[model samples]
Target: MERRNCVVTFLRVLLLVLMASVETTALYGVKLKKKEHRNAYATMMYMGTPRDYEFYVATRVLIKSLVKLQVDADLVVIASLDVPLRWVRALEEEDGAKVVRVENINNPYKGQRYFNKRFKLTLNKLYAWSLVDYERVVMLDADNLFLQKTDELFQCGQFCAVFINPCIFHTGLFVLQPSREVFKDMIHSLETGRENPDGADQGFMGVYFPDLLDQPMFHPPVNGSNLDGQYRLPMGYQMDASYYYLRLRWRVPCGPNSVITFPGALWLKPWYWWSWPVLPLGIQWHETRRQTLGYAAEMPIVIIQSIIFLGIIVMTHVARPGISKLCYRSSDKTTSLIHTALKFIAIWSILAAYLVPFAIIPRTIHPLLGWALYFLGSVALLSIAINSFLLPAIQVFVPLIGVFGSLLVMAYPWYPNGVVRALVVFGYAFCYAPIAWSSVVKVLARLHVSLEREQFLKLVESSAPSGFNKLF
Candidate 1:
């Protein structure tokens, strides 16, 4: 009983922490002030080819956001040896950035060159510590956006970063003091293979600053008294955009933060116009580029995404039934195919029109279209499951409860304002909950049957004696 209670307590704590992390609100309220140190906001980029122009654009937008907010800091670009001289000149002269050329480090993990280039491009970022010109530097990834002024981060100590996991900090945005000694120590760690346990600079830095959380925080003299936990930077300093998908209720996209970092692959980047079709924040990124950088080329992306989106819709209508029938084995293939196709279209029509719009376009831009599509799509999606008889009635009822529950709140006769309108718009996502579950159940049922058959044949083969098996 004691052990069970301890386990429950641990689970509760873990659950609470995860829930807090998902909330797009500020966790800590520690006051911050800019220090007298030479503060710099730095980012790294390597232009291996013309395709690498995306990084250049990302760096420009980052600088523009910083400048727009009037953040008291110098912008530094840690460019690679491969970066074009013209780009370097542009960053320095045109963008008012200080460009520092650094060498690219080879991927420590074999066959991870793609992952390293896209995700863990932080090996060269270590060179920021060698920039003794800046007394203190806040290194941000080129993919980050400034929500507000963050010059006060300079007041923090040598090591300051947000928690990525339970014990490790994300290397996307971090504060550091530049010194040859610290740089050499990191180099030594790299040379000795003692730098990264997880084979990335993220883990490497965590190992380098093992006692970061336990360290005594820097307290400003103006505070008049020693205040505890002044060094701990709030999680709001670097908000992850992925949290948007977790809690559909807390709909403030930017949330309360000084910066929002989109930490993902090339396709997942917000600056990429092709990414606009998928990522909701891509619109804001594109707007920033258009207004600040005078970059407004989006026709190519619109054409491509339209083609892909329409292609998927066409495929869903014409080919989905045929594909779904392949999941099961039947002697009468024609009858099975016909039945599958009929049932699929029936259920798909129940929800496709409703949900597909939400999947395709962001709710902020077209709420009316999204709502219309939501109801239509729900009808299409339901027909596929209902005709197939894969989902239980409870699955349908739960989502209805969600829809009506929100509707009851929204239908309050006295109030009808922006908040209410926003609620009505966003709350429509819950209406498709039953369809999502039904789709999951349908897929799992087919998979279970396939798995069971395979297991049964294996059991039959094993149950027979060795001699009998050999005779057969």
Candidate 2:
């Protein structure tokens, strides 16, 4: 009994010693972590847009790419309080971003009818100053494409931003030294009616930092010391997409050509598939998305749509012969009216075939894949209307061919300048207009013959034609 008691006591003591060692080790790890100052690469997200998923995907791509680059900084997102919880969770769990939710900053300069609706909530960007946990933060816009790691931007002073415009600094990407005091002062400034010429963050910021345009250029120190004052960023950090389109190459002579920003028309943003054919640099954005964030989130919807479209195509093919058996001939006036109605329906359906797929597909998909899917889906839909109505296939598909030709013309790589590209596209359109009109005329003529009384009787027979014919 004594020996057994002694052994049990020994085991208890050993277990206590093991627990102590574990606690000690944990404490040491925490201390080690504390020794490293945490800086952050931050992006902001707000609610209210049909394109939320695309922008969410964009943020993920940005955060995930930064993580993949192994930048010595935390990935952060300053999301508005109203941003969906699911999106916040994805940013945190999937993209490894530490999301800081803040109330939307009310824009004092809102309510003008002509104001761009997109910038209504943009004043919320002021919340970036409130991210005090990080010593420094690089606030980013979702449209930016980071070509390589830009860790050196973290070393910049109180504020730094790229001057993509000659006289105005672009806010698409900027560095900030997080300070609560600065945030509060900015809020006060807003309430006091600070002169915001354009009534958006971009304009307000331009006014607030009036001298940034004249500030000395930023240069990261070799010794790795943090900077302390505002400085102008080199053009390479925010190379405009227009610059590339003009020259078909990057010609920014100074600074590391580190980032590309699309500050053009919202429709022309890099994520849109159509943007790529017009601005070739968009392919690079899609490539980054493919490599980093991927289209996994978008794939299921794309596949479902493809399958539905395919089923429509197959069903149409099966019903073509049955549909043809129904067409025979009727009265001259009745047949003419029916022909007009059929023509209208055929044209409307063809238009829908091209447009509906373009609307429904995920907008952020790669240009080649998106365009191909659109074409396939459209052809499938067009076949149904053409076969069902006995419309001329060649004439009906003319618009589709014209659209393809337009894309080819817009995307031609050898144009010397944007002017030449525009002129060529205009010329193509001018040349194609007659062909399109001729196709329409041919289609109308074909309908006149095809919709004779016997064919009309046959057309209605399968789908209860006697009642339909009686109405005429």
Candidate 3:
């Protein structure tokens, strides 16, 4: 009994010691982190929703620029739960950003006609000042482009921003200290409805820092800008995207601005790739997204698959029997065989083309949509292939095989998510069913006739109305 008691005592003591060491280590790490951020600052941005994830791509570009300039600051992404976990991980692990998840405070007047499309969570911008760990921070809108590192802005006072328009300061970029008092003050103003005239965060901030543009200049700029001189940022710090075109009109390339803000009024931004004349910097945003970790990883697999499938199709078409037989044959044998093969290949080629946008475009908007589309698209392609090329008897097992493979891929440790897995299965079946039906009909129609490609084509063409031949 005494021995057992001693063992118990020893175990308890060991556990206590381990606990104490862990606590000490954790506390020490916190201290080091605080010390690191004491004099340093952070570059911050807010994004929420899949549509807004479009802006996250732009944010990645800004982060890369800051990294290249070797700016002395932390990169912070403040987001809501609407953003996907994969995106959070990408920003945290790949881009070296500290992601803070916060509940979005929606606008109280959501039903107002003018307030329909704007994010009520714009109020969340006030949270920046509450991040007390950082001595100062520069908050940016996701639409801004970083032409050069503006790290020097950290030296300015609490409310430094640009005066791009005559009446109000632009919130596309601004510097401020994190303080609970200021945060509460802004929150109070919001609750009381003392918002900016424009009804966005820009207007709210402009109301709060009304004198920023005309304040007297400080003797020796406390932060980077003259604190009293309306905290005006240098003209080169932020430029309008239109300025790029204006420069081009004169056939000039060089510009004085260090950063470019998109046309805020028109809601036109670089990522809308379909824009006419393709905004000069649209390609730059796409390249940045492709270079980003999660997005980049998906592209090579798609491109390789597309190329392989296309190669097989081209080779098959080229190696088929010579054109003379197809052109001169009185009997429909050659035409039938060629048409059957062409029809099969055509279906798959069109599906592949339809899936290309889903691969790259959906991914930029939301990882879940990207993943759902990819898995479903794969199932659709596989279904069409089996139904078209294989014998009717063997088609029954194709979906089962596809389901098993899809489940395995989803179950793998790297891509595991119960919700995503369920979605993939639903999407897979939804996309595959209709194509499978059409294939079954085609197979049945051919069953009463010859199974050989040549006979099948002849049979189909013989049934067509007379005028169809002249059109061909």
The TM-scores, one per candidate, come to 0.54, 0.79, 0.53
Q: Model 3: residues >4 Å from true position, as ranges? A: 1-35, 38-52, 196-198, 217-236, 244-255, 264-268, 275-277, 286-295, 300-472
Task: Give lDDT tens digits, candidate 1, residues 268-384.
Answer: 687653343344455566666666775343335434555555555555455433433333334233365555564465446444534554555332222223333344445445534
Which digits, one per residue and each the tens of the lDDT, describe model 2 over residues 144-246? 8777777777766677766645667777777787776777788889889898767898988888888865554455456554246322444234556754521
- Score candidate 1 by TM-score against the native: 0.54
Relative to the true structure, candidate 3 reaches a TM of: 0.53
lDDT of 3 at 37: 44
**Largest TM-score belongs to which candidate?**
2
The RMSD of every model to the true structure, in order and in angstroms, is 20.3, 9.8, 15.9
Q: Compared with the true structure, what per-residue lDDT tens digits does model 3 show for residues 1-472?
A: 9999999999999999999975543222112222344433333344544466556676776666556556677777666656778877877787777776656655654555576455566766766776677777778777666656666666655666656656666666667777767776776677787855656677678778877656532124445543344433332244564333212111111235656667544334765543211233444555554554335544666566556555644553442232212332444444667656655564454356346545454334323334444544554444433333332433433444454455454444442544565577577777777766775566545443444556645643654445554434
Cα shift from native, residue 452, model 2 (Å): 3.8
TM-score, candidate number 2: 0.79
The count of residue-pair clashes in candidate 3 stands at 13
